[model samples]
Target: MLALAALPLGVRVTVLEPDEHAPARLCARHLHAPYTDPAALNELAACDAVTLEFENVPVEALAALQDRVPVRPGGALLARSKHRAHEKRALQGAGATTAPFEAIEADTDLPGALARVGGRGILKTSELGYDGKGQARVNSDAELRAAWENLGRVPCVLEGLVSFEREVSLAVARTPAGQVAFGPLVENVHRDGILRSSVFPAQVPDGTEARARELARAVADAWALEGLITLEFFQLPGGDLIVNEVAPRVHNSGHLTQDGGGVSQFEAQVRAVLNLPLSDWRPLHPTAMVNVVGVDGPDGSPLTPDWAAIDALDGTRVHLYHKAHRHGRKVGHVNLVAPDPGTLRARLASLEPLIP
Candidate 1:
């Protein structure tokens, strides 16, 4: 998507992806090899400026390229983001509040750690966990131990659950020159631990928006953020925000901005990385987005989308990822815009059937 957005600017892209079938291949030069492959890293170093669009890229590989070209939101931030414990520290250091958590370094630490988090918490691997994987919700000490054992006894963080009324996300893009443009507080919905939908103009209590804005700016300043950072939060009943997780890249929650009649996150990222001017972050209309989760058929092909039903709908735009489908994978998303929130909700509710 970044490549797609960059095309109009006459910017050439070179993608470093291990997957031969990576979607970016269609739009950019595809270097197909392991991320740690020294040869691939060397080739990537020749680009004018590099930006990481995903987490889990080895920070060492990025560090190697820093001497040759600019790496926005570079190695230090990636190192902090790759581990959950370090991520929480980064959040707190940026003066943002996060959920209570205890680090689990050994089996003996489980009982004490669980008790510290109010005797019940979600145990997540310190590294490489997403979409409900590498984490378990445990209600007992034995369950906590079992969960840790199930994760291969790796270093983990047990975070106590909070009683929050809603989940919201804030995304900000910053340039190396220090200009910042913030996407609005996006109201998000998740089911089975995956993002389902996002709505703009998050209806929060008065003053919540200002605090979220402050946190986004502080984190960007603290990290010396060069591209984009998305901060997902748990919005409490009274509108206080608690950090749920942070992603130092374009995120699922911000997909709605593509059709928001304003500067899309993808384009903002391109402009930020290239040191181009950024527009203000306000949109012209109410917008919403829904993810198209893949549900494969008997022979392992994705279930065909209901085009007839989709065509029957109006005022919605569909974007497909064009990757091989696997059960529970995100294959595409649909966006809808309306003059008001109520109309957008009704139109989005009608899209649910077409996805399944």
Candidate 2:
């Protein structure tokens, strides 16, 4: 998607992926090779500059590429964000608030760690966890032990449960020259640990928006980010915002910017990476973005979408990923833009039946 946006700006994008059927292949020129493949890395290194769409790209691969081509957000940011303990320490070092957390290594006393986190907490793998995977919520010692064992008893972080009022995300872009741009704070709702919807210009408390923007800028600056970064935050009932997680690339929560913000997150990313000027992050209209999850059919395959119903909606744009789907997998998204929030909400409600 970002590649498509970059094309009009005279930026050519070449994607490198191991899966030939990867959805991004539909939109950009693709190299069908493993990310760690030396041949593929050489091809990528030949590019003017390189930026990653997903954060899970191996640090070793990136380090090899960095010697030849510039990797935005850099290896240090990737190394820190990929590990829960490092992420927490980075956020704390930046003076950003985060949930109470304790690291659990192999030799750590599991019961004592659980007790320290109030006995009811989420134990997450230190690395490679997303979309609700690699985490276990436990309320008892037995469950904690089971969770730890289930995770192969690897390194983990135990986070105390938080009573947050709502979840929101802020997407910010920065260039190597210190230029910065911030997208609107988006209020998001998650179902089964997957994001269901993201509404822009979140209806936050009076000072919350300002605070989120400040914190996002601080994070971007802290990392000396050269591309886009997203910060997921938990807004507590008392109007305090705590950093939940960080994604060092274009984020799902900022998908609405594709339609509502003249300069979509993709374009902003391209601009930042190419050293082009960025536009102000202002929405042209109120928008609601709903993720289209895959539904299982009788034979256990993903059911075909209701294209007839989806095509009939006005002011709604549908983006479908050209990939096979599984239950709860993000196949695509629908963007509904309107003159105001009320109308956007109504449109979103009417389109609910077509979501899955």
Candidate 3:
């Protein structure tokens, strides 16, 4: 919602978030904030079009809106994206490399299914999981059983963990005219499996960026996706790329696009949904982003950020999601730009200690 509000030109943007007062369906375990409430459904339903910020939205709700508005990346992508096992299967079927995985229903052949994907693995709920939640690492049946217990013993899929050199992602958008453009590969740094920062101009081999973009386009076309799609991959120790996950909406990794791309992710999605020409996804700066999670002050109140220092950095842009401050919640982000790597690193280092 914040990103869409930053479009470079005047464009109408309407976001349909689940009602804050709705039954609180345990949609994704984490959502920073919503742009509106349920009463606005009529208003949203009357909009020219709609785009999703994440993939966990209920298909039923989207279907309800379909008769009244154009929903980009409609039901097909949503159905495939909601299930982990199905998403990986789609990637492999599309001739994209992916980690080995198995699907398991809480009531069916649980033991044998777990055995199929042998050794230490990551277990994720088939539905309603994101940002390190609804997932657990299992090294044995005990761990698997415990994960089931922790995850409320829901239907889930288990995937063998990829021992990769690093993680990188490509963001691509397809226009109504079938034109496609890709942003450069983003080098991601994860803290305990949750994304902590993203660096543009991924420090990889000469051909890596090209290959990543090609693969991302392939995956998007495979799903017949028509809007923004984010494909995350792991560079294996042998220099091979394996698809780790696919997000059918705007992504955290694309945040740098705001200050460093010809078209920001938000505007690109808008264009794709509106069937406008896709812009070049080239880098506009050597930039990096750090998530501003809610931190407690010494007195136990929500820490009041020094927005002055954050906005003062050269080529820096900050976004603060209007969410109630809570521990570990992603309340906002800080982006910094520099002429070279040295300045970028120094800027990040300078902001790290002060964030908390």
Candidate 4:
């Protein structure tokens, strides 16, 4: 829905979705977030233009779309993101700092992996993994063996976990003509490895923010990418930032931009793909975005949010994704903006009752 909302008014968008229905846009429905979808051939035939919402579409699907209309970022970048090892390798080649890691394949030696990353590391699947799924944290030999068994012994990557102070991210977009624009740095909070909240102007030092933005811009240039790209970073205790990962699509951390930033991530992504000039990247207000997960809501029924109360606050905004309710499902989000981070935090807390 966000991807659709960002489209230029004059540009006609034919959404290539596996869902044969209108209400259910499969483009934004993948759990693992694969950039390619095998059903692309059929979806592309239904329209004159084509675009994608998620990065997890199957490569074969994008190939089909390429035969019809031009696909931004192309299949190569999408394929690179599916495999954790490849994504890390690409970032390294771009001269970006990342955590030490090793690839785990069917015949790959476990002792060789141990030598590269040490005993404690996180095992992530090669393809189709997100929000803590298809991943496991292994600190011992028994855990590693169990994780491999639990994951069906599929190919994976082992990334050594670091003792970082906090998680931060930057969202940037690049035009087909090579122009680029960036959104404000956002601080992310995760619960059980799932994103719970995000705040703009991430309470980091000015120098740190500058470095984050620089890294993001460099990534966009590295890909020669012409769409939204989100780069996750880890702020170390010593005030240095290291790139964690990249997502070649609209990111959860940038959801606050809809009402807080001068140019929303959605709009930026749209303009880039449409070959339009980039908009000014300014902050409308200091904002904090809270994710509303369906964990503690009513069962077997839609949870109706208290909109009247939410609409009363100044600069308070809400966005509800039209998705069916399920455990841990992201149904909607609330963005609260104020003069400072503290005030924004307080305002966000006041809207909790209105969330469900």
As for model 3, its CA RMSD to the true structure in angstroms is: 4.6
Q: lDDT per residue, candidate 3, 281-305, as tens digits?
A: 7567788888887778788888866
For candidate 4, the clash count comes to 12
Task: Report RMSD (Å) for each prediction in the order shown.
Answer: 1.5, 1.4, 4.6, 3.8
lDDT by residue (1-356, candidate 4, tens digit) is: 55455444455445544444433354333222223554545555455334456777677877766656656766777888767889889888877899999887864446556547866889888888888889999987677767877888898888888889999998888877888888878899898778988887688865988888788878778877777778999999866988888888878988888887577777777777777889646468898887878765445655666788888987787887766677777888888889887888788678766765
Clashes of each: 0, 0, 1, 12
- What ranking of all candidate models by TM-score puts the best one first? 1, 2, 3, 4
Residue 180, candidate 4: C-alpha displacement in angstroms: 1.2
- Please list the residue runs of candidate 1 whose C-alpha ends up more than 4 Å from where it truly belongs after superposition: 297-301
Clashing pairs in 3: 260-284
Superposed model 3: Cα runs more than 4 Å off? 1-8, 19-45, 112-115, 297-300, 303-312
> Relative to the true structure, how large is the alpha-carbon lDDT of every model?
0.87, 0.86, 0.75, 0.75
lDDT of 2 at 7: 85
Better structure of 1 and 3 per TM-score: 1
The positional error of residue 168 in candidate 2, measured at the CA in angstroms, is: 0.3
Please, what is the TM-score per model?
0.96, 0.96, 0.88, 0.87
The worst-scoring run of ten residues by lDDT in candidate 1 lies at 278-287
Model 2 misses residue 254 by how many Å? 0.9
Give per-residue lDDT, candidate 2, residue 313: 85
